[model samples]
Target: MQGFFHGYAMNGIDAKNRVSVPSGYREVIEARSHARIIVLAPHEREPCLIGYDQAYSARLYEKLDRRFGDDFGPERDDAARRQFGATEQLGYDDNGRIVLSPMIKELGELDRLAFFIAAGDTFEIWNPNVLLEVKGASDPRLARIVRAQIEAKGGKA
Candidate 1:
């Protein structure tokens, strides 16, 4: 249930905004008690959709609940609940496709293509071109990090 898929190819998204769960990562997702997932709007700086397996989402909700308590003085707590409560449960359809809501699709600016990237404890959906631009801009730093990691592992990168 623990593995990572990095730098995968940008792939097509269906008209309904369905994307296939990566074949390699499917096993990990299936290991969750509920195949359902929580999809959240990307942060303003990032153009991506975060997909958290059910268990992870529950853990997140619990943390937020504890930290914020139930003080609804200025509806701050209400707002937080609304934001996180908007998460949709996603599952593979008849053809093994995962359906994305319109809000999520729009949030990530997803159209015909989406880049599915593995993240720790979840997966991310990104607009292909935008992700490419971001990745391209950070390639040098990323390469350096990879090189350092390889060196740490005692290998030629």
Candidate 2:
């Protein structure tokens, strides 16, 4: 709870494009903020979506501020356009699900099923098949890394 996201879950996206947040993840978000909201943005280099809790989003903003400063320079402008401009704030419904926008689904190549992969400060929403391919289904090293990360976060291995 005090560290990063540390598990994976496969969820179904309904026709309305809504998917339930993993229970553990929902608990983490609820613990951090009163608003049941998640911030999602297209991964900078990957064909997936990156998600962050409100607390982590503030941290991201702080980092961006430090890097860009208050200047109207090109770096600041580009960063703003890429990061802030692309971010989406999604509120959980009564069912603890978030509606994925068409743009988000398209960018991430999401179909009916999505695989949520937990990273340290954030998590990723990926198309199931794409995730398997990208992570290499036969690679034991990836599993080891994920186990290590979960353990480091004080989660069950």
Candidate 3:
């Protein structure tokens, strides 16, 4: 059986805006999608980026289509635009690094570091400080995790 996303990792983004996907997540993506492709988009309710395999993108399309059911209108159009046009299908290098698009960097507010966390079929890429401020403010466990990452980086996560 294919692996599921179930842990967290934090890595540095290079000057070229490239970062390595955690090896654990890569195993899952490679096994299930049969390639190094990942689809990333701005998360709907979070100031972060969500990434998943191409197959999950198809699943999202199907769900979106079923939700709209051929209703050719603004609401449907808006939803489709967000769900389809906004996503980027990117391939990682043999080293498992992906160059973050300008849009992704801006939207995700990523700087030198990216904090990743698993969420079942997808994973999130977050600007560590922003994540700490926005999410960790309320969730103690998340706060601890981010703080630990920062400490690991000698106060740079």
Candidate 4:
């Protein structure tokens, strides 16, 4: 079984927009023989970035087709086509780094700093201070809710 994304806090978006996938986190996914990742602009209110392992992305595509079908009405279809369907495809270089497109960088407001958060099966690229502020403001009740779910599912807290 693949290890759950335990979460990590990254400090910066290195020069060349290279975001390092920590060796610890890399070990978990690499163990599952997945080296490819898909980077998509998330549809969140804050315009965050979402990443998925190849396997997970394939599954998501399958689910979308099943639910939405091939026929997306013109207007809605165009928007979906423009947003999710046409998002960038990135491949890691030999050094296990991928360049974040300007569009993605701008969407996440990642100038010199960013955070790569392990979200399990997928990850998120967030603005560091923004994420910190959001986490700081989150209710403790929500934390308990997360803890309960993780524990109930036999996941490490």
Best by TM-score: 3
lDDT of 4 by residue, 1-157 (tens): 5665666545446778876655555566566547655455664555467765555555666766776786777865665565467366676665666688787778777766556667777677766545545563575653454445445544433
Candidate structures ordered by lDDT, highest first: 3, 2, 1, 4
Off by over 4 Å in 3: none
Candidate 1 C-alpha RMSD relative to the actual structure: 7.5
In terms of lDDT, which candidate is stronger, 1 or 3? 3
For each candidate in the order shown, give its overall lDDT on alpha carbons.
Answer: 0.62, 0.79, 0.88, 0.61
Instruction: Provide C-alpha RMSD values for all models, in order.
Output: 7.5, 6.4, 1.5, 7.8
**Worst lDDT 10-window in candidate 2:** 148-157
- Cα shift from native, residue 57, model 1 (Å): 0.8
Sum up the clashes in candidate 3.
0
Candidate 3, residue 30: lDDT: 87
Candidate 1, residues 39-121, lDDT tens digits: the string is 45564357677765666666777776776787656566675665576567777754557777787788778877655667777
Q: Kindly give the number of clashing pairs for every candidate.
A: 0, 0, 0, 0
Candidate 2 structure quality by residue, lDDT tens digits, 1-157: 3656878876778899999988777777777766689988999988899988888877877888898677869978888788778788899977889998998889888987777888877889887556556774576666565555445544444
